[model samples]
Target: MTRQLVAATKALLVLTLVCGVGYPGAVLLVAQLVPGRAAGQPVLVDGREVGSHLLGQPAGGPGWFQGRPSASDASGELSGGSNLGPSNPDLAAVVADRAASLRAANPDAAAAIPPDALTASASGLDPDISPAYALWQVPRIAKVRGLDESAVRRIVAAHVEDAPLGMLGQPRVNVLALNVALDARTAGEE
Candidate 1:
């Protein structure tokens, strides 16, 4: 019995050191090897950090394309979904309100409001929106930015990112990248 207990103790210590300490240390080392990844791959403007490409920010106005409704209101510290299932009354009411607002803001947008426009992503911090959702806001963006709708659509088109390796997920537009491109295009036109 004593011999068995000694062997078990040794196994426990070995597993703890290898799985707990060594694995995490190796992970940190591997992560640090990537450029800008350890810091969330910051999005920069004018040499200043604007935000992280992995996180969402509040929409500026009708001129800017919006991402999904952020359940935590895009708060990095409170990143989470609303936790409300479909058919939950509270969720329904919120979606209704969001739909109404989208209609009011985008009266010229002929497409049906995309699901992404009314619903928050599973991660409240999702930085990307479906291509459909981004295009739906094009008319409003074009009008507000004083660019032709086709020009704004082209900018959105240029920024669309294909799914990873061509199969992992659907195409998406990173809202920050899209808005930055819009600002750059607008500045150049002036």
Candidate 2:
């Protein structure tokens, strides 16, 4: 029994040091060396920090590019999903309301809306949206920004990221990055 206990204790200490200390240090070192991905990939504007690529934030104004639904609290530290099943009445109501608002805001868009625009993301903290979802809001965003719709659409197109290694995932646009670009362009124009 004593031999077994000593062996277990030694194994635990070694594993803990290796995983808890060495692994994290190596990861941090590598992250620091990467370009465009260091320090949490913070989104900045006019030399000021705005948000992060990993988190979603509310874009209340029409001129700003909106992110996916956030399941996080206002502070964005506690992340979670709505956990409402598809058949939940509350989920249906919320989706309906969001669809109505999108329609009202973009009367020129097609009546059929994208699912991403209406449905909450699993984590509710997704910072990206489908390229189609971003395009759907272009007309409304252009109108609010007093910019040409084509120009705004072009920016969205430029920001559209292809799937991982070409085909693993759908195209997505990081909302915070797009919005920051929008603000920078608008500021430059002014």
Candidate 3:
């Protein structure tokens, strides 16, 4: 019994030191080598931090591009989806309401609203939106910012980031980055 207990204790200590301490330390060292990402890739404006590029946030006003509807109210710490099934009535109602609001805001968007606009991402923290959705808001943003529609479209086009591995996922535009660029452009015109 004593021999077995000693052996088990030794094994536990060794495993804990390697798996818990050594592994995590190595990972932290590796993560630190990559700049900005370890700190959540914050989006800055005029040297001031505005928000994280990796998380969803309100786009401020009609002049800014909006991201997907977030289940956590755009709070990064409380990440989760609504988890409502397709047949759920509440989900349908919420989507309908969101679509209505979007139409009201962007009356010139004649195209069908993209699904990502009405539905929150599975992680409730997606910072990107479909390119179609970003384009849909061009008219409203241009009108609100008093900028030409073509200029706004150009900004959107420039910010469209390709998916990882090229074919792994759909292309998306980061709302925070796009908005920051919009702000910079508008500021430059002043």
Q: Which candidate number maximizes TM-score? A: 3
The positional error of residue 12 in candidate 3, measured at the CA in angstroms, is 3.5
Candidate 3 on 1-190: residue-level lDDT in tens? Answer: 9999999999999999999999999989999998699999988777999999888887787878988998898886888999999999999999999999999999999899999999989988899999999999999999999999999999999999998999989999999999989999999989
**TM-score of every prediction relative to native:** 0.87, 0.83, 0.92
lDDT tens digits by residue: candidate 2, 1-190:
9999999999999999999999998988888788567666787666888888877778868778777665564245667778889989999998888888888878877647888888777777788999988988888888888899898998899999999999998999999889888887788779
After TM-score superposition, what is the CA distance of residue 76 in candidate 3 from its true location, in Å? Answer: 2.0
RMSD of each: 2.7, 2.5, 1.6
Badly placed stretches (over 4 Å) of model 3 are 1-5
Clash total of candidate 3: 0
Tens digit of per-residue lDDT, candidate 1, span 1-190 = 9999999999999999999999999998998898688889998999988788888988788889888899899998998999999979999999999999999999999989999999998879999999999999999999998999999989989999999999999999999999888989999999
Better of 1 and 2 by TM-score: 1
Give the range where candidate 3 is weakest over 10 consecutive residues by summed lDDT: 54-63
* lDDT against the true structure, each candidate: 0.92, 0.83, 0.92
Which regions of candidate 1 are displaced past 4 Å? 1-21
Clashes of each: 0, 2, 0
Error of 1 at 54 (Å): 0.9
Candidate order by decreasing TM-score: 3, 1, 2
